[model samples]
Target: MGATKIDRARVADTALRLLNEVGLEGLTLRAIARELDVKAPALYWHFKDKQALLDEMATEMLRRMAAETAGPAPEDWRRGLADAMSALRSHLLRYRDGAKVYSGTHYTDTSYAEPMERHLRMLVDGGFTPGTAARAWFTAYSYTIGYVIEEQAMGPDPSALPSGAEAAANPPADPAPYDLGARATRLAGHPLAVAAGEELFTRHDPGFRAGLAAVVEGIAATLHPDGAKRGESGP
Candidate 1:
């Protein structure tokens, strides 16, 4: 293929596919080139290095998220924030190690601008000052990223736990290690700690939504004490 034929989008697409196959650690310029039926040098023409390619892949992921979630902004600021966050979580969960891939990469591409502007506008119109709106966005974004990272680390079945009988029969060789059961016992006397431990060890979706709701409520309290009653006019 000609140099002009290899674009950043193509490279990003290949990298995303490779992400599912070999995961983030195995995704490399050489591997992408091999999948593309091109030499490693050919990929360099598009991306300067692996980080550059990874950035584009992250950008592509966001672009897809924007496309998938595109719609009329919800009139309710809380609803708008919830919808955006839900969309973000869904997209991040689509690929293996996707949260790790997207956590810190900056998208230099302009395609992220429209969705970003829309999200900010949603908050700003909902009675948040421009500064507060930006902060709210970042706060919610951080929560979503962190939640997904932990969720991914726990694997697909968040409820998978050793039974009490199983644990008693086969105790760990090293008792001092971080054990969920032990940790739960330590927090048993504290209601809040027990609730948090339940949320952490059990299903993550409800907990994620609950946490997002709390974040939104806190932001609303800070920016609009009246809960932005009239802030749902437009976006």
Candidate 2:
């Protein structure tokens, strides 16, 4: 058989698939090449290095997210902000180490510009100044990204253990589950911590929503107080 015709998209797609199988630490050019039925050097022709490939992968991930999360921007800035962020968090949680893969990587194309502009415009239309809108978006973005990083860290591999070099590169990041009884025992000295553990560790969905609501409210109260009232034109 002949070598598979490789392109940047092909490489990124393969890397993303391997990401769940091996994870970010274990994802390498050589492995991707093996999957592609090509030598590692052939991959370098498209992606100069692993980081370059990662950048492409991140871009593709964002592109997929944009495609999957299609809707009219909510007129209410708070709901709009929360909805946008919720979608982002959902997308980032799709792959193993997904948040890490997306965190620092730059988009390889202008595809991100449209979605960002649409969101910023949603805030601006809701009465925020352009600068404040950008800041508001960044605040939510930072919160969601940081939250997912910690979430992924808590249970890096939700399935099987890492094997071979994957194991060496990334020892299991799994932490002990802080159940109520365990929390009471392990954190007996700190009653508050023990009490908080249930909400903090065991209840991720509600906790995230509650925190996001706080973030939305804080932004309205602080950054653009009038924006919420103006934005309340829609659900």
Candidate 3:
């Protein structure tokens, strides 16, 4: 395609694919231009620099996330917030180093406004003051983004162990030589330590969900200081 035909969407799409192949550090405007079979300068027509391209990429990802998560507004604003966050996490995990890429860039596009308004409205309807609603949305968003970044950093799950033959051919090295069993035994009298140890070393999904639940609960508590509670909304 000609340089004039190469729009920001096309550039962002190519950049996202390159991200999965080369990761965030390796992704560059030149790399995207190469992928498009064009000179590096051609990409500059759509994006001023790598940062501009990254911002567009982040905006595109969030655009898709907003679309996928959009529907009839939920009656329970907490549920709406939770579902929106879950969708955001799912979208970020769709690409390699996605959370890092997303966290590094800002969404400057007008497309971001709709979802932002929707989320803010949900929180406001949930009894939060306008300022508190904005804070609540960002607080949850920051938590999800930070959690996913750490989860991605840890690499894939060990429980998805390699085949027996593969394991025998290339046995994984034990970075932490301390026997978890023995450590658990030593801490048997301290239930809290044992639980904390287990949570620290295991797959992060359950813990992530638990933490997300706590965050939602905290938001709910803030919205409803009295013993009375809001009615649950249907999916």
**Residue pairs in collision within model 1:** none
Q: 66, model 3: CA deviation in Å?
A: 1.5
Off by over 4 Å in 1: 1-5, 157-197, 225-235
Rank the models by TM-score, top first: 2, 1, 3
Candidate 1 has its poorest 10 consecutive residues by lDDT at 171-180
Q: In candidate 3, what are the lDDT values of residues 55-161, reduced to their tens digit?
A: 88899998888788776668788788888888888788768778988986878769888888887887777688788788788889999999888766655423333
Off by over 4 Å in 2: 156-183, 225-235
Total clashes in model 1, counting residue pairs 3 or more apart in sequence or in different chains: 0
Shift of residue 31 alpha carbon in model 3, Å = 1.4
- Best model per lDDT: 2
Over 4 Å off, model 3: 1-5, 157-197, 223-235
Error of 3 at 134 (Å): 0.9
Predicted structure 3: clash tally: 0
Worst window of 10 by summed lDDT in candidate 2: 171-180
Measured against the true structure, the TM-scores of the candidates, in listed sequence, are 0.77, 0.86, 0.76
